[model samples]
Target: MTIALRRRLLAEFTGTALLVTAVVGSGIMATTLSPDDVGLQLLENSVATAFALGALILIFGPVSGAHLNPVVSVADWFLGRSAGTGLTGRDLAGYVAAQTLGAIGGSILANLMFDLAAVDFAAKDRAAGHLWLGEVVATTGLILLIFALARSGRAPVAPAAVGAYIGAAYWFTSSTSFANPAVTIGRAFTDTFAGISPASVPGFVAAQLVGLAVGICLLTALHPDAGTAADQVVAPTGERDPVLGHRP
Candidate 1:
């Protein structure tokens, strides 16, 4: 593998790991702090997650576009394929693998931090139809918002915007807006406040995929030339260096 691709992969892995750490870690902390009130726990969790997400984006946006979500990476690849501006097929595969593994690692790390067993394998069942529908809506809105910002020359604000949307989605969407397949899988490894049952993963993932398709269709309708801006999705990182495929 080329050095540039390797660096991007490393960024993806580390960024995703830290993002999940914020999520699972904060959830664990919130529950401990607000053991008596689910509302307060959620409030704390949402706040921490929103802040961490925005900060992580700013820290890693210059590399790999900080696409901590697999759907976001996939969307970038699909939209930029015609223009040759986004992730190549190999990059996509590498990114997904890195992000997924990073997520699992983050979950394990979070558990360890809390003095809990590693790989707890969450038992919280969330197999309701309403939750599945929530995932679809949450994922659709997230994808649409990210691409919309890029298409409208507003990529710079994506860090805050994406974070705020997710924070709001936590309360508005019944599923708390997992919206990410890698995250979904990672959360399953913990039985904490932020974890989901392994048995429910397939339904959520399926719903997210459906949301992905819907979001892309909506984006094309709204911005017929959105593909041209694929490289700027989530955030702008400038032209890739000839040798590193990253901004110098």
Candidate 2:
């Protein structure tokens, strides 16, 4: 019941809420504004999501690691257990709960803001082996990017690197890179272009978990002694996040 833990949970909740808000909100706007151009709609949605995510990471990276994603939280916990520098099991539970609830709230907020029903289920059916493959690849790449930066002592670059990778994955992956279980669950509540059907959610989540396993294995193989710093996933406190052409 420390204040720091509370702050971390709050940051995770608020940060995740904003991230999902940008995602579902922008998707709704894109479909409405560019009804005829699917490509353009995707572009708009991806850009908004990318920028919003980077900003959220930069703003909250020092607190709660800005995990925003449950898998990231769990991955950090698992990876840092031996090093004693990651989230405790209790912290993991709190963070996952906050993220999941925040994601749902974000979806509801987006729907309400756009005058849509608060709990309308998505009708977009995104099922298929190939699409699942895309989810696996997308999630795997995401984990790789985060941990890779941490291993190489380049974690300060993670905000931009993660954002850029996701922006690009939206175009490269057939599934548009949902890549996140919390996000996938939240998007199921909306019937917008960004939404996924409830039926498809379980499969997508399973694929993401598989991808997580693969990413963990790859990290161990590549850097068995990777540092257990918080910045492995989110930026640390007081750092500038290296924006404005400082990527490397």
Candidate 3:
């Protein structure tokens, strides 16, 4: 691989690993700190996730667009498909693989840090039409927020804005805003407060994909002239790509 592509892949891997570490790690800590108070635990988990996500984006946006989410990467490719100027197919595959592996590795690391068994299958069965709908809503909002910032040339504010949106969605959405497919998969490896069962992953992923489609349609209708997308969800620095920056 070229040096630039390698750097981007490394950024995606490391950024995603850290993001999941914050998420699963905080959830573990929250449960320990507030054994009986689910509300308090959720609050702690959401706040940590929000802050960590924002920070990760800021740290890695310039290097790799800090996608940290497979759906976001896929959306970028799809948006730029007509022009073929955004993430190439190879980049897409590499990014998704790195994110997925990083997610699993993060989960394992979090579990080990808490003295818990690594690769514990999550028992939380987040199944139900309403909860699935919540996933759809959460994912939809996430994608909309991400591309909306890029389309509007407001990429710099994405870190804070996306973080804020996720924090809010945690309370507003039934699924606690597990809007990311890689995250969803990672959570399945841990039987923690933030986890979903493996059986439920497909449904959640399906919902997220549907939400992605909705977000893209909305983005196109809202900003037909939007030429490129941003590297990070909320905050991209440096040059922007026609669909997402092509900065090497």
Error of 3 at 120 (Å): 0.7
Candidate 2 local lDDT, residue 189: 90
Task: Estimate TM-scores for all models.
Answer: 0.94, 0.92, 0.91
For model 3, the stretches where C-alpha displacement exceeds 4 angstroms are 1-3, 230-234, 237-248
User: What's the lDDT for all of these models?
Assistant: 0.91, 0.86, 0.84
Estimate the overall C-alpha local distance difference test score of candidate 3: 0.84
Winner by lDDT? 1
Report clashes for each candidate as comma-separated counts. Answer: 0, 0, 8
Task: Identify the candidate with maximal TM-score.
Answer: 1
**Per-residue lDDT of candidate 3, residues 1-248 (tens digit):** 12388888898889888888899999999999999999999999999999999899889887788889998888888786775445779989999999999999899889999999989999989878888888889888888888888877888888898889989999999888888899889889999888889999998989888888887888788876443653334455345455654754
C-alpha lDDT of residue 167 in model 3: 90
lDDT of 2: 0.86
Candidate 3 RMSD to the correct structure: 3.8
Cand. 1 TM to true fold: 0.94
Residue pairs that clash (backbone atoms under 3 angstroms), model 3 = 65-231, 158-234, 227-242, 228-242, 228-243, 229-243, 241-244, 241-245
